[model samples]
Target: MNTTEIFLLAMLLIFTAPYLVWRFCKTDYFAPLVIVQIIGGIVLGPGVLGAAFPDYYQFVFTAPVVQSLNGIAWWGVMLFVMLAGMELDLKKVWQYRRESATTAGFALGVPLLFGCAAAMLLLGYQGWMGVKGKNWQFLLGIGMACAVTALPVLVLLMEKLDILRQPMGQRLLRYASLDDVAIWGVLAIILLDWERMGRQAGFLLAFAVLTPLFRRLMARLGEDDRWYVSLIWLALCGFGADWAGLHFMVGAFLAGVVMDAHWFEQRKLDMLFKHVLLVLMPVFFLSTGLRTKWDAGSYPVFFVAGLLLLASVGGKLAGAHLAGKMLKWKQGEASIIGWLLQTKGLIEIIFANILLDKQIITSDMFTALLLMAAASTMLTVPVVQPRLHRESHAGLMQQASS
Candidate 1:
């Protein structure tokens, strides 16, 4: 088949397989379509489908087809990350400064420590760290990956649980948003190449100067014009970041961070986010899968995946529990909040992809992190549902008595 036909076939698999599993299998209660799509990518990756049917895998995912898919994935993730940055409400965090800081700090800090310890163990071995990665870079990268919470996915899960408009939901969003900013900041630090220090410094300096001007221009534009302008801005920032030895994704986030979400209509922004997820992000997931490997060592991929999951989930819960103690949150709130905050959905995968691209973490590490992310995400709904239900029921009874 021609490359175009082959690419279409690859896309066909990407869209159809995940949809069937998510729709017919009714996995949405436990695993959302995004999580399912991620799992589908792993299933279709070289490690799984390729291992089982190398001939078919090679035939379908030819180099040209893979390259074609990659183009879509790159732009898709850039848009998605930008939207996530726009959704950040630093203003809200400021309003609840004390509570937000306490929660966000412990939530990010504890898991980061735990993940660092885990990375320490991995560092003792060969094949886990990337070619260009220093020990500190690998350690910090893995640690930050554990500390990540997918703010976008958290919003979806909260909406699914019908807590999206609630005070608790708002509180969770604040914590996740704060952590999201920190995650990217830490990534920029990790990606800092002393060799390219001059370029990186110039990019930051230019970004600082251009940000206000860009915001001013965006402010003056109509909503229709803003959308077009934002895309052009996204492209330029992405190019600039990549040229500066930082990843384009970092540029994408910076582009979004400076803009006000209030500038765009909420419904339109939400639709754009949804469309990006539905249409484009799946390709990113598949591309992520294409990069998965299991050649780390004698240890199996699932075993490594499990260890990372323990570190990530355990650290998150530990952090939340600490916050609950500090903030005097009621009983049962910690468990629910901790589980929800531990969700490492799209953002975790994105972070892992960056680590792989920067050669900070090996492909096996990426695969392990991917599994950790999917498992962590899937666990969120199941674990939180009962606690949420009990809380709701209790609230109703209390209200009735009052």
Candidate 2:
């Protein structure tokens, strides 16, 4: 009917469609609700649903409605990124510097190189690179996309595996956290606009000067006040970064990393994540899906998706196994760690979105990356659960023999 009614109807689909499939189909073991939501978004996007039912799709996903949804998605993801940043334990990462460095380095570097190779393969084809994107930027953007591990998603999967509070889980977080920092750093490099380099420099300088003062202010406030102030700060940093030619998510992350996690109540922080995912992130997924396209042809796009997936999984495993060899880890340890770190969920999509915004990657490339990320995430639990069980059984056998 009206725009308001249409927007409400769109929101209905965003929340309900995925939940029904996820719950009724019992896809939890392999495909979590988040995975279902992402797949649903793709299915509901212009390329699929709109192509199939143009009038119905256009009616529901009108310009104003899509814009509203995008605004919500932007804030939702920014807040999500902030939470991820707040979870970083730089102090602990430094404590185990050598081990963390080796593991994180291999985990990120090897996959990065593989992803670059994959990018090189795509260069021969048309419709993959964004017009505004330089050859090196496209390569590095694709490379980093493969190397990402969604720290928030990793925490959830580890919790599901009952390993989140374990020593190994802590180790995994350390490694992911370090990689998380590097991921954003690489993104900044990719998003660098030469014409706006001066503005970007000023943004960083201002950020460094402001961060400590902001931290001190946060420390002095009551928890309730801190939350409100943090939101305000999040908005301002996002604006500042966008103005400086960097993405707003970078600013949102800076807002979080500067604040001590201890400044907020742990239970509140948990609720923050829970509520954000439940209430907000689905819209982001839907918006991401709307941007997906088959411009590179379905076959080539899917083929590229397959290639990226292979590089992502293979490189992560190779890197992890190499780390295990150097550190003398137990049998089957690398398998579990490698599979777990291969996860690339919301963060990868967000990374690809940023690239798309700057015209680094075309819609087809975005779609392929989206597929690669969703498939990688969906594979994590199924693959790792069996490996964990097998590893445990072998450990028991060795103990009995002893």
Candidate 3:
């Protein structure tokens, strides 16, 4: 009907989905809750329900409402990324430095190389098949999409499964965290290259240099009831990055990492992020879901989607498994690690949406990538949990025998 009513309905659904999942399922199915909410949004939006009730769907998925929701969702993602960065224990990273470095390098490098190649081939095919955009741009977009991993989701899984404390798990987390930093750096460079060229690149260099100086100043701020100053500083980081044409999440993440070196107020900031994530992260996914326009009966699109899903899963598995073997890990452990690292959830969707908005990739490509991400995420828990559990048990028995 009206904008207010539409907003209220979306809000209501967002609040209710988690409750429904918690009541019915007890296995920490929060990701699936998000997936369901997105599907529900699509059904209730202009795709299905809109086909039957055109006026209502038109009003519901209006430009203003979508934009407002997108802004809220982005704020949610910023907090989420901050929390993800805070989850990193720098000491643990150092302790497992060699293994972590090897793993992270292999995990990131292999996927990026493969993704770039796959994008070239796949985008070429898409061009042949008469999809939009120049081949080079579409290929760049595809490469960018495939190269991303959902760092937040991976961290959450490690935390939820109590794996963060294990030796292998610690190594995985360290590498994944570092991999995220590298990916973001690459993304920043790419965005700057595409958007503002030389000026943006120069500003980013200055920001990098100034970030540490700012951190030192923040540290020197008196601890005599001056924590609110830190919040102001964090806000300034967000604002500055936004002004510099960088995503606010980048600023928020850097802020978390810099402050991570100092223990001051880390816990408080983390708790604040947790609260924000629980409420708002789903909204991000719901917005992504609302944008999903899957053609259930289109064989070409469906076939391409399935192929991409296979590539996403297989590519990660091959990369991680080979890396693990090189690091002299047991075969089973290496396989499981590969599978776990394959997860792609909200963060991947966020990146895909960004690329789509930039018109670097078409709607069909975005949908395919989204599907690939969701499928990969769903496969992680099932493939990883049993192996991790078995490893824990074996380690315990080995300790007892000793």
Clashing pairs in 1: none
Quote the positional error of residue 150 for candidate 1 in Å: 0.2
Q: Write one digit per residue (lDDT tens) for candidate 2, span 1-402.
A: 899999999999999999999999999999999889999999999888988888999899999999999999999999999999999999999999999999999999999999999999999988999999899999999999999999999999999999999888999999999999999999988888899999999999999998888888988899999999999999989999999999999898888888888988999999999999999999999999999988424698899999999999999999999999998998888889999999999889988999999999999999999999999999999999988888778979989999
lDDT of 3 at 66: 82
Clash pairs, model 2 backbone = none
Worst 10 residues of 3 by lDDT: 124-133
Q: What TM value does model 2 have?
A: 0.98
Q: TM-score of model 1 relative to the true fold?
A: 0.98
lDDT tens string, model 1, 346-387?
999999999999999988889989999999999999999999
Worst 10 residues of 1 by lDDT: 294-303
Task: Give the count of colliding residue pairs in each prediction.
Answer: 0, 0, 0
- lDDT scores for all predictions? 0.93, 0.93, 0.66
Per-residue lDDT tens digits of candidate 3, residues 1-402? 688888877677666855576457763443555455444444554445656777766666688888888888877776666666666667776787887778877776776666667666675454211233455555555555565667667766777677766776666777777777776676565445354555566656766787788667766776543356545656666666666666676676666665653545657665666677667876786677666664556455556666666666776777788777787777587777777777777667766766665556766666667767776777777778887788879979989999
